[model samples]
Target: MSEHDKPGRIAPYPRPAGGWDAIKFSAASLRQEKVVLGNLKAFLKQNQPHGFDCPGCAWPERRHTNRLEFCENGVKAVAAEITSKLVTANFFARHTVTELMRQSDLELEQHGRLAVPLRYDPTSDTYRPIEWDQAFALIAEQLHALDSPNQASFYASGRTSNEAAYLFQLFARLYGTNNFPDCSNMCHEATSRGLPGTVGIGKGTVTLEDFELADAILIFGQNPGTNHPRMLGELRDAARRGATIVSINPLRERGLERFSSPQHAAEVLAGGSTELCSLFIRPSLGGDFALIKAMAKRVVELDDAACATGGERVLDVAFIETHTVGIDEFLADLRQESWSLLIEESGVPREEIERLTQLFVRARSVIATWGMGITQHRRSVPTIQLLSNLMMLRGQIGRPGAGLCPVRGHSNVQGNRTVGIEERPTAAFLDRLAAVYGFEPPREHGLDVVATIQAMLAGSVKVFFGLGGNFVMAAPDTPRTFEAMRRCALTVQVATKLNRSHLVHGQQALLLPTLGRSEIDLQEGIEQSVTVEDSMSMVHLSRGFKPPASDQLLSEVAIIARLAEAVVGNRLVDWRALATDNSLIRNHIAQVFEAFTDYNRRVAAPGGFHLGVASRDRVWKTASGKAQFVVHPLDLDTPIHRARRQYGDQAMVLMTTRSHDQYNTTIYALDDRYRGVYGQRDVVFANRRDIDRLGCRPGDRVDLSTIWDDGIERRLNGLLLVEYDIPLGCLAAYFPEANPLVPLDSVGDESNTPTAKSIPVRMLPHLD
Candidate 1:
């Protein structure tokens, strides 16, 4: 059999990341999408000064230095958007919803772009084409028929433009509800909740320029090669400058070990990979809290030793005294933590933790970056705060090259929250919005993603509206979430392509096709531009020059405006006029938020402008007016650990991960090149010791079930085992497939984000 015919073959990738293979794969994506010649111009326009931003990742762009600013994944995203394949009315007529649900996510995406609006026909069990006006009117009728505004939920995805998100929030509030469930709640909500109490801001404090001046970079729970490939360029430059780099993750990811910049002709042609990290510390799943505390304890011990010897102080006492509070309490808690407990909880040796602390002491400037792996745990908020406490010892905040960086997943997830797509709107934000719009906005907190699911299942939330996402696939507890979706009275989705969400319908469902990021958005015979904010808080203009996929498709801004008009009839605001001019929406936004002063004029400048962060400027907005050092106990008596202790060798912590071939919920292919599994995504990665302990051999098929207290039985069968480099008692699997194992109620304490990285599961070998 040929290599492609193999189901679950294990072979290590020979070469390092980003060489000629990257270019070849990118070309393959273009050919598969049938955009080989048409996407050439899009490659030049992406991430440029006056061009559209990439729809793939949230990594900030640099000044216009190179002609090609897009990465391999960015090329794939653009090619998919500008593909010649179309899903017309005739295509939908060929298949029923029940039939479509059986296809794999990859096959569904391969069918291509949705051309027109459609509505579900229950009697026929098919989706039939519907006119835009009639669809909007029907949605309005269902929403109006609801008993209260709280009965309807509005969901926003991460890729939505700032203009569309602002309009969406405004409309939802005007209708008298704060029921906004956004995509950010799934990934980085821990950063949003943890940062504010300690650093007085919810966003990252570092800029793109800070990476160039750093003496050390510590990455935690992030694989930038597959998720944010462009970050490899920055790490490559930092490594070349003799900077010390360290990575703390359960798996030794290839992206952090070494990388070759695809943009650099010399490196690609010479086949040389730059060494990224000096130290790779492997911590068990959900162990970051204990790991960070261990590092802090060692730092305090070193400082005391230095003081006794009359050597230079290791800690920055002067800066800490002036800019921070609660140091005494933080240190006391650190001293109470035992060495044995720290080692056991973190799954790292004392020697390794001490080595990491010494590196931190020697580097003058450092940047601590983390991803969802650190956020999707029950103790995620406390873990982030502990990290902040460790950095405050050296007074790393408000410096040239030292601060916190929470790498966001989607290109515009942060932007959506910035534009008020939030369920728990602050009093100040509501006041300003009410003052600007001349109406009373909703004051009570509303349902988030988790709450929305529960409310829907209880039959309280009747109507559901989504703005660009596959909600069924992205949410946790796939079986339960699918049932909740079916309970909805009316469901509406605005997207560019078909997804699983459209197949899992409510009593009545409407699918509205919208323009993609790389397509022209003409409004009232004039072209318009929308803006997006990157992870580093750089807001820039995105203008699309290519023709749209279908003339029937509408811009997100236009769709929201017309729907609002149909529902509310434009009382105080002119919805029709705002739909034609995005500047008008910016004008309204500038009036509500002070940071957006002169939004239209400022964003028109090249490379856009930066939204100033208070913490970065040494201005704390906390109640104490100073940075606070929070204290968290070193404890690992969580649900997963308890289950492991009770079930003995049967329980293992499973973490859901993204494959190299996929973006969020969109699956591009079945291959995960980095971990070396091809033609299948059902394989599980486990340490060799764990494999032996579980009585499983290489390539053995097993049935996995969740070890939850809830009576619900969630099981996934026929998963092939692959012996790999992972921490003991931990197994790794791809997301959406493994999402079923994560219970809906198992979430972070304050953030309410699902613990996708800390699931307790039991393995049963298949009897074959």
Candidate 2:
């Protein structure tokens, strides 16, 4: 049975983050995964020079100065990837598809690594072993049978290597389709879409070194303790160095409040913790847009006051005049904005907004960082641009210690985009691809994640191919997404282990087992190393020393190359050569993308090379040749706000969160140590006043029914309520479990990212 059906404990955690508990839990994870201590040699190499990058968060690596370069969650990801257990054909034979569906996500992953290729057998509701060549042939047949290339939707996960992602995109385009719906579409698409027009770069401009030199760090809607544990060290050092750290999130994250490094024996032994955040601001869910506007308003107000008093100018007038455009229109909107409406919309007191603004003003240099919380909202794009406006007012960009940083979830998610795994490819990028290779790439844009699902429901998208990731669990509206997947004529998943997406198959499905990130990738009697780009746009080599989980497993590059060969054939480019030597693929990448010039030799350097961002050099790529301060009208018509308008006091905004034990869709354990939830994944966090006002009690089990105009009755049942530190009228729940509450149509404007962070929900009495 699923763990969601089980009872769990909720208690207050007495200690700060990353103490003895972190070490214990990490060790427990390694033991649970059956990774012996002797095998830990590979773990030590994580994030080190000439070593593989951690397959967890996209946090950049600093110069190797310590023995242990991995974090607690990094160890969990490493343990899960290099586990000794195997899911052989016998394991599948023992459990039918219907039976396996009853198992929880954690149980499915814990069954271990997939050892061979499997093809779905509808007659027995089981998967049978299939030869690699035969599997490729089946895929090619399905593609050929498709009415049009657009009928096939190619999806990629962030876990894919640069070489593999490049090959995957190349294959899809060569086959004549731009339907690449990637994981970035769900998470950082807001940053990708928003930042380009404003700052001329979609990715973050800050480097790890910038964090060290920053005078103040403003963290927005991100919890570093769980999502990016390694970042805690940086935050800790920043705090110790007297840098002002401001945490602007709904819940008071333990990671942001205080962090005790597990690696530091002195701190752990002393049972003391370093306070991370100087100020903590809790805004309502989806309130960042208004909160940021309020801060910007305060900045302009302070500047006007300072000018009137003949004091030092608060606004960098000279810098603004030189480096920015649209300031007059932006300032006009800010000046006209009502403080009462801003306070009501943000649910933040005017004093807190002023305090945050003062911190931004006092700091000589600042770094603004955010995560999915800032991206998964209706006004996410404008909110980010507003943040840019705040930074530009102080001349923060193009400086050593001040820039924008979006903390990406997956290890290579940013890299995946860098290597052409995008649905809407730029004409210049397509032109470069056509010039480098001997083919005319597709010029028309293609379907993203949400569009792909809509197409599948309409029976237009027939084939679904996934490079990696559990698409069923990752996408919003879990049941509807599953149904959409089931409607596909053929589905193909290239993965390392079993997931819900594998069982919820199409009319015909193929499961191609691939090597994990920790496995040795050998091609043509030589070991091959893959490259990945960290969150900071640093492209580095990732080489694994361990043997493959099974001999049947192939590297992701090999799988894509062989599949491409089977379908497209060796007409334009030699797929076989590209698969054997990743360097050749790197050469192709360099030719296609100018940033990767001399990719092979440059990546071989110590700590790898940074693919430079133009925004850092103040070279804005916008039409006006200056940073654009685009303005957005105050949007109270967002899903949550609309629901409030319709439902009165019953409406509450909900956000999906990741547990400490899990990364993305992969669950390692049930315990959320930081939140003091033991053995549970089905709990909702709410403010005590909301619980009381709503006629609900702590520990009450309830069902969350999403409020959408589409009339689809989407609900997740039997969630235990826990009164906690959060803003009024807002609730928090674990992702994938709470993913059901998010309507597929409810997405960020312009970005098209599912509004997982701001779902309008109504609590109902638990049924069944």
Q: Report the C-alpha lDDT of model 2 over 1-768, residue by residue, as the tens digit.
A: 333223487777878899888898888888899996667898778888877888888998885446688889999999988889999999889889999999999999999889999999999899999999999999999999988999999999999999999999999999999999999999999999999889988989899999889999999989999999989999999999999999999989888888889888899999989999989999999889999999988999989899999999999998899999999998899999999999999999988988888889999999999999899998899999889888999899989999999999999999999999999999999999888888999988999999999999999999999999999899999888999999999999989878899999899999999987777888888889999998898999998878898999999999999999999999988999998999999999998898999999999987899999999889999989999999887886677778888899799999999988899999998988778787888899999998888677999988899999787899888899998999998999998899888899999899999999999999876867
Return the TM-score for each candidate structure. Answer: 0.99, 0.98
User: Weakest 10 consecutive residues, lDDT, candidate 2?
Assistant: 1-10
Residue 678 of model 2: what lDDT?
76
> Local error of candidate 2 at 413, Å?
0.5
| Steric clash pairs (candidate 2) | none
Clashing residue pairs, backbone N/CA/C < 3 A, model 1: none
- C-alpha lDDT score of every prediction, in listed order: 0.91, 0.91
Candidate 2: residue 216 Cα off by (Å): 0.8
Model 1 off-target regions past 4 Å? 1-7
Models, CA RMSD each: 1.1, 1.9
